[model samples]
Target: MRTIVAQDVVSASKFNRFHLLVFLWCFYAIGFDGFDIAMYGVGLPWMMEEWNLSALQAGAVGSYSLFGMMVGALVLAPVADKFGRKNVIIICMFLFSAFTLAAGLSPNITMFTIMRFIAAIGMGGLMPNCISLMTEYSPKKQRALLVGAIYIGYALGGILASLIGMYLVPQTDWRVLYYIGAIPLLTIPFFIKQFPESLSYYLARQQVGKVVEILNKVKPDGNFSEKDDYQLHTALKDGKGFPVKKLFTNKRAFTTIAFWIAIFCTMMMAYGLNTWLPKIMQSSGFSLTSSLSFNIMLCVGQIAGTLIGGYLAGKIGYRKVLVSLYLMGVVTFIALSITTNVALVYFLIFLGGASTVGAMNLGNPYITEFYPREIRATGMGYAQAIGRIGSILAPTLIAMLLVTGIDPKMAFATFAVPSILAVLGYLLVQEKYGSFDKVVEENGMNEEFIEGENKRIIQS
Candidate 1:
């Protein structure tokens, strides 16, 4: 009888054609998500002009999308567990693309806000689900780099948003940007045909026929048949039960809380800057075109930061790299407030983008390391959902500060507040708690459980 070790498959991870496909689809999916979310920020100035919106109303429009993202991350992301990741991706794609297309037709801010909020609900699940699925497909040693690599999609998506805004908004209407969001709706059918299901999900269901098929693609050993038995590491098994309880199980309570707090703080910075930086730059005396152009630098910085941070994490560690990014944020934000040199201002915004969105992107893979496949999306979703509260608050709060005639320097400095808070929260994360080996060792989950044929899946 043939026996396959699931842990061994992941441990001796190798990249092949399968991994490349996963990477491309995930990158495209997330890039689409990025485009959808950032379009609001990119088009915000024109929308404000068209609607004659006050600072408060403009800020409220940004928050509407975030509010929907909160719901998707909090409520919809966990559905990936039951329905499967590929299915959820398709549903999310349709919701966002169709509604974003509908949004372009809205005649007023109220309707635009409603359509954006629903589209964002689709946007919310994309990150957690994509991050979770990618983590599953990546090799253990290369996990950080590959996971971090896919996140460049968010920056790429944002970059596309800015480019489209620059060319289209000035020539036509801001609503035209929303029309572009519907482009993804065409790819939903393609995803179903090409995207693979989670290997762990197949194993959990004891669908040995399907598991053998997918596993062979990832790690092809031609001698497999339905008669063979396979077992997963006890620690890796997606145990059945309430997933949230598992977040705190086996000495993880403190670390889970720390992740939520840090996510909350970091997201406030990431979404706040993405939504408002262009407007703030325009307010600081740059022309509208120039302000929009700066957003491309911001996204470029995110791509650069993730690659740099991923490399640094390999040298130092994920936790340390995250802290360094936050410290960088503290200084860059302050510098941005006082700088008048256009070149220097662009550089500062570059740093701001890296420290803000880059940190959030880096944090996802780190957070997923703690959970089994069954609940990876759930943990990520909840963390982002809690983080979404801060996001939901950011635009309005920044708008409130702007309307009060606060010094531009002080308004910029406020972003630094959450950066510091994120640093402190991550400082408190006990890395040992995230270690699967530690959990296995502490609970005394035995070799027999890891070796027996589908033992954990059956017992659970």
Candidate 2:
């Protein structure tokens, strides 16, 4: 009997109900992740008024969630690789849902901040795991597009939160937003019932039985049996040990570091804008409802960007698409700094969201292709963890700058720096590693390309 590699089965299978279920479930989970993360900003105006918070104090409160996300990404995401992606996702979902509800009930800034931080831990862990699971299940040709599709949930979540703030916040209170945020808890039971474990994860563990079980569902026609042997088409070693060390080894050091830089820069801009865009617009004389509507427009642009970026990535390739997006981000931010017309400002905000948030979403599929199954979640986790450091600084830095009397226009222009740096970081990444179809055809998986490319880099 011939050896059956799990990925080949997945790659060759037609899109089926199993794939749709997995995609929809991940989409639902990440939507809530976006909602929880963006809620702080949506409610910040109200919180500031209700609590008499200084700009710095409000920014600090937002930073707590980013800090928690950093810790969660660094500490908890790697555990998914060790245990299972499905399990980590479930735990993360429960944590964020329950704590977001708790956050709404807080009587003081300290307690509210603490609850937000705790909720963020779950949000952080949930995102990368969803990306990893989606990546593993998707066919090579559709991987980036599928991952991007799942990420549309994030933008949708942001839009939903902004809409709630616009219609409900004025009628009720800021706490009502948090109450709506808790609705994700209901999906946990559905996830427990429906979510499938990553076939690659099981294959990495040499769990032949489980791999067979999943492959059957993934491609019911495969009719996989325990009598068949299995293999993964990657060059990385598999063993019973921590995979974090592997990120720095196998000539991955530079690629990993460069990837982290791109992640950090992109995330800084993303969190910074998401956390402050509404407030910044309000300061510019927009009504509170109108400012929140700007957030909705921003998220709507993110949805457009993710879909368009995914399509372009599939056509032009990931590196070119990402580089172009970051470059466009530079232009959009600069334009946003100077634009005065309300219609133009909204259009600029939409473009800025597309470039920043859309580019950030693109990073997941791009990075997913770089690492092997053994460390995919870990590599993504560490990259996101480092990025969270930027996320942590973004809102606070913007707040401090405004509080110190810097013009909001100049503050917006400052965003151009990270956009420029992100371009550089993307440039530094080995393009051969990112060419999904070519690598998949030539080496069966991109990790083999990374391993071989690293060898040449070391030798030269």
Candidate 3:
């Protein structure tokens, strides 16, 4: 079989029509994940009103979803390697679509909570695999940009959910929003027909015939030669077994753990504010209408931040950009907590949303770049799973303080501490490690390092 060389990825302009089509599917899957996740925030106010829930009860809903996501990311990420990325993604989409629709059909709080939990699993699994698939298929130089760009779907979804919720809140029931969520299911069949499994996975698994088929599909005019056979084996063998264990086995152990911790801290700040910001503002004397409108600004900032982060990371480097953004976020979170001036609060809120969302968008691709294709999904998954833990705790902890009549600024301040942890984590990882390229070369995955230096990360 002819080998798809690393150089082929470097010259992205040569990507044939088939690659572009597959690329579209990858974007679509992530887009669906983005929409489903953001839907929770949009429905929060209406659901609380309809059920007469306490602030703690409302927070529980967010917790349940994060809990579900944690479980999903842990379970599905590794299993996707064993089974296949495409199949797992298809199943994950179905799980969330069906359960989210069930959320609409719930008669009481118990059912809605249960359904959201189920949907969270699907939501959690969908993200890492979507990221992995995109990375695995992309040209080396474009990996970070494409990965970050695809996440725009996430911010877009957040905006879409807010818009839909705002528009429908006046006329239709909140339950109907869940019904609209199920629309993602319609794309499942189309994905199944068009999606390609990761070439790296197939090569590693020694499915030579399938690898050749996929490569031919990826590069229709290119010829496969026997010399490519050795490279395929090298790529496939690069990252097999307990990926998390492997990450820790080398000098990378501490750095890897630090990155995960950074992700956790970053997500805690993001989700804490996302799930509770409106509630906190309302309690601080803002009207529900104004609080709801704030989401539009937040999402707009998120989109801008995501685009800017992607571009900046491509130019400056991911970790530096992420660290700087997190610091900015911490400052904004502080400003948001203390300010009562409506206009200024809105501006700070938007800036805060931009930093947090952009940081996440930039960070995921950075994590994905740390591993070879064989274990890339798993690494991203563990980071996301651990990150979900932060998300799970943020709303719960903030709610507990608020219920006890603690100061609202103090409650927000509690959530802001994680950003400091994240900054420390990034700095520690960067200071401790060499470029990831040396590690990958030392680990002997040299042949499979298809992407160039621009996309390569240090071991951390």
Candidate 4:
């Protein structure tokens, strides 16, 4: 009996129903993640009015959820590495949904803020694990596109939140939005039934039975047997030294630090804009309806940007693409500061969304490519957690500046500075570590295995 490496089986398989199923579920999970996060921003204007919140108070409320997400990303995400991706994701889905529902029922701002924080723990855990599972299941050639496609759900979620707010919030209470967030819980039963554990996780555990079972589904034609052994083509084996510690060893220290910096700056800008864009537009003389419309436009641009950015990164290189996006983002922010025309403001906001939110999401595939499977979740989780520092600060900082009587354009320009720093971070990474593809190739299995499998399938 011949031994088949798990990854080879996945890479060699044709795009089929199984891959589509995985994509759909991952997309569903991530879409809700975005919806839950964006709901606060969509409802913020109403909450401020109803509660009589000062800018600082509202900003602090926004930070509560982000801080919870930081805890979840840093603390809860690593558990997926030890337990299983499917289990952790299911738990997280339940955690966020239940608490978000509770948030709607809170009587006071303190209670509401507490619920949001608790719910965010689950929100934070879902993203990295979802990204990791998607990466594990995807073919190397299509990895970037798959990651990007799944995250389009995130943009869709944001759009949905904006739409709900626009239509429902005016006619009803803001709590209705939180009630809608609870809808994701209905999908939990289906997820329990359909979602598969990562094959790499199983293979890492040396669980031959589970590996063969999933591989059979992944490549239905393959007659995988119990006697057939499995391998991973990776240098580090499962249960190696502290997963987090490994990140700093083998010359990964600098790349790891650089990537963290990139995530931090990009996330600061992304979250800042996400939390405050509507308010900023409103302050700039746009009506509430027009401001929310800008939020929708921002998400529309993000959807387009993710697809386009992923395609461009595949062709030119991830580093070049990110650096260019960040530079373009800086220019767009400056344009936004000076523009008074409503139409121009909409255009600039769309571009800003593309450069900020879209660019930030593009980092997921790059991070997955950089780390080994053994610690991929940990590496990603830590990066996300550190980035949350910026997320945590974004809303509060913008609020403070605005409340202090600073020009809204200057406030936005302050946010733009992070994009320049992000560009520098990417350049430093390229200088130190080389291209994203090169790093992935160094860590990945031999190309011949992929080619040979394709040839064998064709011959069969």
- TM-score of candidate 3 against the unseen true structure: 0.89
Backbone clash tally (model 3) = 7
**Runs with alpha carbons beyond 4 Å of true place in candidate 4:** 232-236, 430-460
**Considering every candidate listed, which one attains the maximal lDDT?**
2
Clashes of 4: 0
Error of 2 at 9 (Å): 1.6
Cα lDDT of model 3 by residue, 341-419, tens digit: 8898778777877778778888887887776556778888998999999899988888888889877766656646787
TM-score of 2: 0.93
RMSD of each: 4.5, 4.4, 4.7, 3.7
Tens-digit lDDT track of model 2 for 1-460: 6566566566555688888988999999999999988888999988999999999999888888899998888887789988888999988988899999999999989999999899999988988888888887886667778899887899999998898889988899999989988887887887888788877567666678888888888878667888876744342247356779988775678888889999999998999999999889888888989999999999988988899999998888788988998999999899889889999988988888888889989988788767776678888899999999999999899999998776676678888899999999988987454323222333322222223333211000
- Model 2 off-target regions past 4 Å? 232-237, 433-460
lDDT of 1: 0.81
Give the CA lDDT, 0 to 100, for residue 313 in model 3. 78
* lDDT scores in order: 0.81, 0.83, 0.74, 0.82
Residues 1-460, candidate 1: write the lDDT tens digits: 6566554454344788988898999999898888887898898888887889998988888887898999998777678866677778788888899999989999898888898889999988878888988888886657778889898988998999999888877888888888888988988888888888876667767777877777677767535567766764442355567777777886778988999999999889888888888888888877878888888999999998899998787567789999999999999998888777889988988898889888888888889866666788888888989999999999999999989887655687888889998999899987765643111111222223322122322110
Worst 10 residues of 3 by lDDT: 438-447
Backbone clash count, each prediction separately: 0, 0, 7, 0
Cα lDDT tens digits, model 4, 379-449, are: 88888998999899999999988988877766778867999989887777633332132212222333334
